[model samples]
Target: MIRKDRAVVWGRFVRTRSGLRHHHPMTRKIEEAQPTWFRLSEESWNEIREAYRNGATAKELAVRWKVSPSSIYRHAWEGGWSKKRSADADARAHAEAIAEEERADQTRPDPEAGLFGPPGADDEAMLGDPAALAEQAMAASVRAMRARLFVEAEKLARLSEAYGRMAEKRGGPAVTIETIDLETLYDIVMNKDGRVGERFRVDPDDPGPRDPILVRYWSHRYAEREAFKEQIRRVRANARKAACRAVGLDPDAPLPGF
Candidate 1:
């Protein structure tokens, strides 16, 4: 009985020892799997070297070393690692510099802004408001009409003298002068005398009868005078239209065609 009990105790001890030996490698692996921050006793450089040898990435080495990726890159460089990673970093930095320069250029002021001068000044003012521009045009047209009227009046006076002279030379009745409304004036000027010497005249030196020239000149002068008066009438009509428009009246209403 004593021999059998000793055999049992020896067998139990052998089994326990074998089990411990089997679990030892697994325990070492588990310890290795723990985070590097918890395994603080190991040197960071040594850890990096061991991790790199085991095919670890730079980011993994950075985390394990508790340092930046740039630090890992520096160490890799000093240790004669691949230069491709460094070249990639250089290319990235150059790209960033070019992007920054482009952004600055896009934010610069436009060159065209200076050539036309500053906003809200004389250059802008000359464009003129609609009402003021209309008034100025009307005034200029009235002045032109007045000048045309002066020229026509002088011609009419000459025609009156010529008619008196012709009547005296032919011993006939003197020509009559009449005042008529705007409608009659246009009709008479357009239809009278076949637009002969009354409308236009040849130069005095030209080989033509003075009577035909005088008749054509007078006719043309009359037409031109009527046209000038018509323009004045139209201007007045427009002024009235503008006034009516200011007062919210319809500008195209049948007041006059003028």
Candidate 2:
């Protein structure tokens, strides 16, 4: 059996641990019995308003004020305290909206600009300006033409290489030198409906004809090209994931690519 004094001490200790005190029950009873209207000093109310305006959360303000977060919210609501309007916020939203509109506009080709210009208007525009403007326009046109020619030349070079390889494999007649209709030939070669063979009337025994071997070679080449494209796509995806991981983001989480 425990001593009476020790038992009382132990009970008091337990009550204290459980957050009960001598005045707790009486205070609760008194509060329940009485009508209450809480009031605060003007300074205290100003401090609360300032805390809310400065972005201190209600819960944080409650901790500082020794009150519940809900009480802080109720007081703020009742006292008409609210977040202050920020000029920066308005500016940022406006800028974002403008940027979005610009991005959308970029996808649509304007008839007055670049490759989408009216059919015969571009040449006249290039020639119609003051000396400097005309010179600049001519320079731009020349640059564009040069770029197009370079691309065509590069494509012809690749086709010539392919033809050379084919000729070497066949061990037939040497490749004769002539200007090739490269764009037309490229379209024909890439066509799926056997249109190239039909257009050229390529008989099995005809000389300098594109044969099944050439078609099979190009088919394999296309497959390899697709595989390369897939590889590039995978590489870009992995790079994005790695970047996200570096910034403490979940790599597997869905994200807007744009």
Query: Taking the candidates one at a time, how many backbone clashes does each contain?
Result: 15, 0
Q: How far off is residue 60 in model 1, in Å?
A: 99
List the global CA lDDT of all models.
Answer: 0.56, 0.59
Name the 10 consecutive residues with the lowest summed lDDT in model 1: 20-29
Clashing pairs in 2: none
Scored by TM-score, the top model is 2
142: Cα error in model 2, Å = 66
Mind giving the per-residue lDDT tens digits that candidate 1 earns over 39-136?
33437576675566456777766554555556667777788655454567667888999999999989987543232234455434644343333343
lDDT string, candidate 2, 1-258, tens digits:
224433423222223455533322112232322222356577986897777866888766655555556777887788766665544565688899999999989987653244223446466664433443334444444444555655544444444455555545556444332454677657755974788756544356756647576767678877999999999999999999999999999999887794
Q: What is the lDDT of candidate 2?
A: 0.59
What's the TM-score of each model vs. the native? 0.18, 0.22
For model 2, the superposed segments whose C-alpha errors exceed 4 Å read: 1-38, 84-258
* lDDT of model 2 at position 156: 42
